[model samples]
Target: MQKSLLIALIITVIGAVAIHQFGTALPAYAAFVLGAVLVAIALTVVSNQPSSASNAKYSGPTKTLYVGNLPYRVHENEVKALFAKFGPVNSVRLVRDRKTGRRKGFGFVEMSDTGADKALDKLNDYTFQERTLKVREARTQESSGDRD
Candidate 1:
């Protein structure tokens, strides 16, 4: 918080000095434009820095896998066929739009614990229908709200 305040103070001082120095010499609009540009540059510089908090890794184990980047025409049976080679699949759910009843290009697959691990290892980033698949352990929903 202190660092951000210090940076803001510094930017304000710089912008004020620039506007005061050039406001009389140049047009009034030029001073405002220069202040705007300086503020934008300052914000861009601050936002571009990477922070460690955004690098968190998933720690929980999951038996259900999320399959993404699927073709629109792909069905649940096709997904099952692709994953069946890894192990016995328990269930395959292809998300679809309720109003349109069309595939949503993503789904969830549940399998035995060992089978899920095997499938995740082998199929993650695997190419399907010319697109790389993003297969990962599905995060469980915390809410018990109506999902019908």
Candidate 2:
């Protein structure tokens, strides 16, 4: 993160200098456009670099668990905390309606396989927030589509 920030700062300074030096010779909009292009290029270069976190591998297989019957008010952090009791939670994605930006009463949780199994055993049909939870392995796109 620091490296990316430093690169962005350097790019911004260079762009400012270029604009200042050539502002008199070019139209006002041209200088602004040049700065915008430089910033875009710098961001693209920074984003293309592999993230260090992505290179690390977990000791156990990671499983994506389906968590359904979630209360509409339940958020990602709540789901993470509930699952964290069994094992490390890598991520929690509570699905939401794009148009309304509201929770969709379901979500996906990623954790180690062992943890996922434990969670499924304990949480399946568990009452949470006045609703019975449906915890199980998340179906792959192909399998889910075939069912439909």
Candidate 3:
């Protein structure tokens, strides 16, 4: 976003200098205004996109929970609805196989720390879709041996 703003400012300055030197015609002024508007719209939309790391933004302290034993049929919305009962769910990410794009029977959920604690207590070992769910605080994955 900062980068985008910087670029926009630079373009505006150059445009202003060109207009002042050339004695801007009506069409040139209109084009300048239209271009600025279009750029502003594009920048606003591009900057608002969610980051890949965490889709949801929590207002308070957040916790990420590891959810295991998910049914193959389960999905993000269902996980979110289930967790929403305990507290505001930040995000639900169901793991999928890279090649097959199939559910991996596990995922992660983010929420307020207090809400996450409640969810862990109540949902762990709870049966859902004929499978027992395993809910616990998520641990960072260890670095892979092959990765540089």
**TM-score comparison, 1 vs 3, better candidate:** 3
By TM-score: ranked, best first: 2, 3, 1
- TM-scores for every predicted model: 0.53, 0.60, 0.58
Clashes of each: 0, 0, 0
lDDT of 2 by residue, 1-148 (tens): 7887686677766776678686778755576567767887868887898865323344668899999999999988788888888977888999999999999999999988998999999999999999999998999998998873
Between prediction 1 and prediction 3, which has the larger lDDT?
Answer: 3
* Candidate 1 displacement at residue 29 in angstroms: 99
- Whole-model lDDT for model 3 versus the true structure? 0.84
Per-residue lDDT for 128 in model 1? 88
Highest TM-score model number: 2
- For all candidates in order, the CA lDDT equals 0.78, 0.84, 0.84
* Model 3 regions lying over 4 Å from their true place: 1-57, 142-148
Positional deviation of 135 in candidate 1, in angstroms?
0.6
Stretches of candidate 1 exceeding 4 Å from the true structure: 1-62, 143-148
**CA displacement after TM-score superposition, residue 100 of candidate 3 (Å):** 0.4
- Which scores greater on TM-score, model 1 or model 2? 2
- Whichever of 2 and 3 has more TM-score, that candidate is 2
